[model samples]
Target: MWLVLAFAVAGGLAQLVDGTLGMGFGVTSATVLLALGVAPATASAATHAAKLPTTLISGLSHWREGNIDVRILLRVALPGMVGGFLGAVVLTSISLEAAKGWMAGLLLFFGFVILLRFGFGFRLIPVPKNGERTRWLAPIGVLGGFVDATGGGGWGPVVTPSLMTVTRHEPRKVVGTVNAAEFAVAVSVSTGFVTGAAHQDIPWLPVLGLVLGGVCIAPIAARLAGRLPHAPMGTMVGGLVILVNLVTVVSLLGGLPGWLDAILIVAWLALVGRLAWRAWEKEKAGRLAVVGNPGVNA
Candidate 1:
């Protein structure tokens, strides 16, 4: 019971960060769950199950902001649904240990890409323009859906950036639209999981706790988002992601000795403490900026 509560609190904090920063929910939730001794597949399933309603709420908020592109959603959703189904099936068949190794590698690659200083960073695929390129939406949707189901999170890391690059939308608009569209994906995939072969592993209590916690914190995070400077906020989020991936890699590779795990946990606590302090400073600065320059507005 207490463990469930702890997981819920951890998930809520993750949701707060994700809601405000435009990313991090899946990775954060999945990592924390794994650290708690849950199987990777089970953790992914539980997280997705819980995220369905939470994403819907956030997506609706984004929609009210006029950030959704209905046409784009219509184009991608069917393929995404199919891909998510397929991915879930695949996950059921895979070895959890192997999946963890692959997931760690992918996370490391993504982190490295994000850390790049210049010249294309991590994006290799060029943004598709109009016509046939837009048609690529189905395949992209399929892959994103599949990976997200299997990995526990890919909306922000895979789908949002891809859509933004392809459609040339503003970052904020992309974030909003992606959040909305992901609600659809999460709902579809989660429904399939509930009815399909993967239903047995569902951790009902923990999942419910996570959903409730996320619901409570989401609005608060969203409200804070508009107040922070984009560049610094993005950098901080990216840095945190990098640190998380590094830890994931070390843990997966058996590089973290027994003694080192304790040290890493302490470091993790310190890192999160620093993040909170920085966020407070940023919020204060933003408020001051607004007060000192009345005409400037984000």
Candidate 2:
């Protein structure tokens, strides 16, 4: 009961954040599962399975809201699906405890990329269909899919940042397209886990709890992303990505002391706060600067 409730709540919160910010669902949910001592392979399988519903709902909402790019979705999703399948197979064969460390490091690296994007106000847009730059999505999708399946969660963390840094699309659209594409990745990862891993590996109750909880909030999160101002949300999502991965990295490094945890959290909060203030100031300035003629009045 308590366990079920915890999983349900965690899933809901994760979905909400993922939907709103374009990332965090799998990593957040998997982090919690790992803390509860779930096996790595099982955790990855369960996370992928749980993502089925959340991603479906989220993708639908984004599609309806005109946030997705069909071409981008197809291009990236196909490779991601292939990568996810391969990653799941690798996870089953490798010593996951060792693999987990590498995954954490990789995620942490991307977390910093996201922060750099937000910190510097990068405005990378997508190129034309015929442009060579558009081809980069294939490799990004491949890496994203592989890491996501093996790490139990990282598609958005990896895909979103890479796309944002290189692509010419708006952040909101990229988030939506990536999320919409994630349906394929999630499905592929789950199939790999179910057929390749031990049949009894997944914990059914936790999977059910997460799915039930995530379904309810999935639409709401997509709507929020569509409506929310991009800059502020980017800061929030970037900060959160870094913070969450830092915790994971810390835990992997034999866990931190109480004071260290507090210090890290406080620092994280301070960075978000500063970014938030800057976003607000920019918004206020934009609002004040109407496009009306500056001709002399009267």
Q: What are the root-mean-square deviations of the candidates from the true structure over C-alphas?
A: 4.8, 4.6
State the lDDT of candidate 1 residue by residue for 179-247, as single tens digits: 666777787777666655666776687787788778787666665555444433444445555566567
TM-score of 2: 0.81
Model 2, stretches more than 4 Å misplaced?
Answer: 119-132, 165-167, 230-244, 254-258, 283-298
TM-score of each: 0.76, 0.81
> Model 2: which residue pairs collide?
125-167, 125-168, 126-167, 126-168, 126-169
CA shift of 176, model 2, Å: 2.2
Query: Which 10-residue span in candidate 1 carries the lowest summed lDDT?
Result: 113-122
Q: Can you write out model 2's per-residue Cα lDDT over 1-298, one digit (the tens) per residue? A: 8877878897887787678667778877776666567767778888988899889988999899888989888989999999999998888777767766765665566556555555546533443454336668899889889989887888987888677666677767888998899889999998888777633677888888898888888887777874555456556666776676678778888998989899979988898879867975775455446325345221
